[model samples]
Target: MEMQVWASLFGVILGGLLSYLAQFTTVRLAARNEEKRQAAQRAEARRSERLELLREFIAITQAGIRIAEERDQAPDWDAAGTPEWFAAARNIIDRLWVAERMIEVLFSPQMYQLARAYASAVDHVLWRLPEQIAAEGSMWDHLRGPQHEFLAGARTDVGSLP
Candidate 1:
């Protein structure tokens, strides 16, 4: 009778140990899974931010291209600087300023450089349109090569990232 009582007590103790170990393992696994979930969420947020920034960059760059192409229409930039020209330039400059600020915060150095190249191409058009057109008869024709190059480089940069 005493042996039977001892066996039952041992069995109870073993069952309790087993229960404790199972709970401990389950808690650790749950914590690990939570950490993974949080990390994945952070990564996704950063990716969305990068995509949004790139989209804004593309928008501003395309607007600048359109402006450059439009300037190609006027006989001279002196003649082109009408109210409409100033208004369009103002709008584009404002948006470009915002994009540049975002780039400074979010982009890698190479990405920023690509953006700067595109912006500089636009500035070149804005500053030298009259002279370029006066000399070459079609300003955009000359600028198009560099503009395309900058834009393509930027696109490649964006595509290469995961």
Candidate 2:
């Protein structure tokens, strides 16, 4: 009789400990999963923002190229750096800067650095734009390289452009 009682008590204690351990483990796993999910969401948001920024840069670049192509020729020879194109390029650079900050905020440090580099390259090309276009040469030919680079980098997101 005494042996039976001790066995029952031991069983109860073992069951309680097992249950507690299982619950604790499950909670830890749940927390870990939530953290992963949150990080993935943040990373995805950063990628999307980067894609959008690239698209904007491409559009602005293309627009400037278009203006130069359309309005510049032998007799017309509009200064490639018209106020309108400058305003457009400036807006693009401003937006690119803002997007870079957002990427820094949302992406992992490595990804943020890579994206920053890409944005900077695109910005540099766009910024040098007016001078490159106006300096005794038509810009259309010069624009092709940067235009291709930006468009290629942004291809996944560029499909949505109308």
Candidate 3:
């Protein structure tokens, strides 16, 4: 009877120890999985935000290009300070400003440098041709390569359109 009691106690202690170990392992795995899941979620959120910013930046750049094109094609655009001409000029400037700010806010440092280079190209054209319009053909040509590289690197759907 004493031997039987000893055997039962041994079995009970072993069972308790096994149960505790199993529970501990399960809790540890669960915590690890939760951490991994949260990390993935944060990475996804950052990717989404970056995509949105890229879209906005590209859209603003496109708008600025279109405005410049329209101004180039306009008749009597040489008549500086005329209401219509002034409005187009203002629109182009405003859109470029917005693009610059977008790059500043959304771009990584290296990306910002590349984008700023593009913007600087545009600025140079604008400064040189303050009163002229279609003269920016060279500027657009210069931007095409860098713009394509930027878009490709970013993996964004925004295309580099002249």
lDDT scores in order: 0.75, 0.60, 0.65
The TM-score between candidate 1 and the true structure equals 0.78
List clashing residue pairs in candidate 1: none
| TM-score of every model versus the real structure | 0.78, 0.60, 0.72
* Model 2: how far residue 51 lies from native, Å: 1.2
Report RMSD for candidate 1. Answer: 2.8
Residue 111 accuracy (lDDT) in model 3: 71
TM-score for candidate 2? 0.60
Better of 1 and 2 by lDDT: 1
Winner on TM-score (1 vs 3)? 1
Clashes of each: 0, 0, 0
**Rank list by lDDT:** 1, 3, 2
The reply for model 1, stretches above 4 Å from the true place, is: 132-162
> What is the TM-score ranking, best to worst?
1, 3, 2
Give one digit per residue, the lDDT tens place, for model 1 in 1-162: 999999999999999999999999999999999999999898779878888887887788778767867776666656777888878887897788679668867767766776676666666666564556578766566567766775686677667655
**What would the TM-score be for candidate 3 when compared with the true structure?**
0.72
Please identify which of the two predictions, 1 or 3, would achieve the higher lDDT against the true structure: 1
